[model samples]
Target: MSTQDPQPESTGSIRRVESSTAASGSSVEETPPSTETTESSSRQSLFAEEELSVLRLRWDEVQSGFVDDPRECVQKADGLVSDVVDRLTTGFSEARSRLEEQWARGEEGSTEDLRLALKRYREFFQRLLAL
Candidate 1:
């Protein structure tokens, strides 16, 4: 099996959140691994360390702009957050694929994968709010 699972289609969940943020933020911008979304909840595809590092760096770039460009910072933050949500969504799907493959092979599927994804989701939620 391929180590890389194909990324899924962008169903409207991210857009639904983006639309809500638009109503609130671009006017007011904000982001999800919504527990309400079964796909996000079903499995954990943890970010590889390199991916997490890049995200952290992107976040730093957004945050560092606050003094000179608060509005731009907000916009950039919105973009960065949406990117992270997309990554998480991909991660969840990859984990689900791995779990299913493991199951078929008679190996244990780690709930810890899902657990970590949930943790990242929670962090994403809290960070979006804090921004």
Candidate 2:
């Protein structure tokens, strides 16, 4: 019924879902990683193990409920996905903030740039007035 081979988890941080579980959308709980993942290279940036487990349980409930109310199940899945996205983006947002701070040292100094530009403009104006 399927042609896809079971693939290993690319990042140590994210748990790999079984081929069956992924396809059927049942038992979406992530299995323990076969090998330890590096923290810096973790696929999931923000969610801790406990939080991921909770999300898996909640997702299982959402999938199981499809038999009763498909519409509600879809809505719940949407919410869960949205929550994960928010968590992921929060990591990026924080990293960007830190980078901005680091760049303030000289990499991206708008203050100095503005000062230089203003001085150049004054010199250009004075030269034009002389002409």
Candidate 3:
């Protein structure tokens, strides 16, 4: 009796691994381990590195000022969060507009490209839900 190694099947961003035991005619299906770092790096960021650094600096200032004026610190934090949300909303809108333009111009991207875009949207939606 021989056991075969699991074979990988990819469907868009998702992958499935399947293995079967010939003796008992049993099969198992599993999802492969996620490469979070690689995948996250590949996905587009809503903010630039410089923007993120500036935001971090501002956050640090707000935190440091909390000891002096707690109410003002809370207000600043609320404003910062609002700005971040606005920026994120604008970023997503811009991306969607670009894609829509391409489609309208008869330049619809490849199936894989569209699939990746949808995957990114799904990931963003999941994150928003978590919040």
Candidate 4:
């Protein structure tokens, strides 16, 4: 006969694997996010930034023509600026959604940065359009 002390049962020693019927009859397993998803998101954000920068540069180029003109020229430039602002606003909205979603996945550094940059650029462009 072995000499051993009898141990009392405790919650820590319990192993209860409940049936799925207790919940939804199914267990969900989380999968890591795909690289393709991340890369595609990154590419879209980069494209938005590049597009805005190019548009801004073109606006500056065009504004040169109005530098020495009358009020009519200023009004025309104002209209053009408004159109560009609308386009940039749309792009900024889309990028903000994507960047926010990506950021929710715990990748905050670059994604947060891009979101802020896009937002700032949007505001800056709108200010210019107002002028």
Candidate 5:
């Protein structure tokens, strides 16, 4: 009997994978993300550049202190993680609140805008799940 792996399937604009079985070996093909997807992903940064820089600096300090004080380093790392999570939660909450306010004011967003918002949410949710 012969067995072969399932072929990769294309899904949306983010990923496209193709595979073929040949006499000698199998080959896989990857499709680059579309320009729109690339631009949107770049714009989806959760933190501003300055905020990210500060977080990276704090992380470096925590990592460097680990050899001298492991426990303190762990505690500091935990606190930093908590702060990042809180900031992300707050950002999402504020965005949702703004959308709710618009709806309450009878200001409906365009269908395309709403679709894009939902797509972003789904992508974020998927990334969280992956982590």
Candidate 6:
């Protein structure tokens, strides 16, 4: 007697899928991982660094002018303002240093140093704008 079993035909209407219960559990339908987003973010950081450097240079120039003529009348008003500016500048510089140190330590992501750095940067910009 013949003992061959009949094979099932593939139906075009319903496709066969790998069941999750199968060997590898489930087939991962992978979309392409993105590097473009990371590249753009890096570019943005570089741009911000460049722009901040320019602003720092400009601040230095403005500060130098304020000290060029140290007359009694001008000194009276300028001295207090200069002191405030100096404090802000120093704070900003300290924040930048801490941020750089943290980044060097590979703590760039979700760090307090980054937050402090951004905050100080804003303060520096505001001070510059006030001038």
Task: Work out the TM-score per prediction.
Answer: 0.39, 0.46, 0.61, 0.28, 0.64, 0.35
User: 70-113, model 1: which lDDT tens digit per residue?
Assistant: 99999998887676667656655665676688889998645544
lDDT of 4 at 126: 39
lDDT of each: 0.50, 0.45, 0.52, 0.43, 0.53, 0.38
Task: Please identify model 6 stretches exceeding 4 Å from their true place.
Answer: 1-71, 109-116, 123-131
The full ranking of all candidates by lDDT, starting with the best, is: 5, 3, 1, 2, 4, 6
- The segments of candidate 4 whose C-alpha lies over 4 angstroms from its true place after superposition are 1-83, 111-126
Quickly count the clashes in candidate 2: 0
lDDT, candidate 6, equals 0.38
Over the full model, what C-alpha lDDT does candidate 5 score relative to the true structure?
Answer: 0.53
Kindly list the per-residue Cα lDDT of model 4 for residues 1-131, writing each as its tens digit: 01111111111121111222322323332343255533333223222344445545555655666757757566766765565545545655655676788789876756335534543454344334533
**Candidate 4: C-alpha lDDT:** 0.43
Best by lDDT: 5
lDDT of 3 by residue, 40-101 (tens): 43343444445556667777788789999999999998887776666666655666787899
- RMSD (Cα, Å) for all candidates, in order, is 15.9, 22.1, 14.5, 26.8, 14.9, 28.4
On a 0 to 1 TM-score scale, where does candidate 5 land against the true structure? 0.64
The list of candidate 5 runs beyond 4 A from truth reads 1-44
- lDDT of model 5 at position 21: 23
Which run of 10 residues does model 3 get worst, by summed lDDT? 1-10
Worst 10 residues of 1 by lDDT: 12-21
Clashes of each: 2, 0, 0, 0, 0, 0
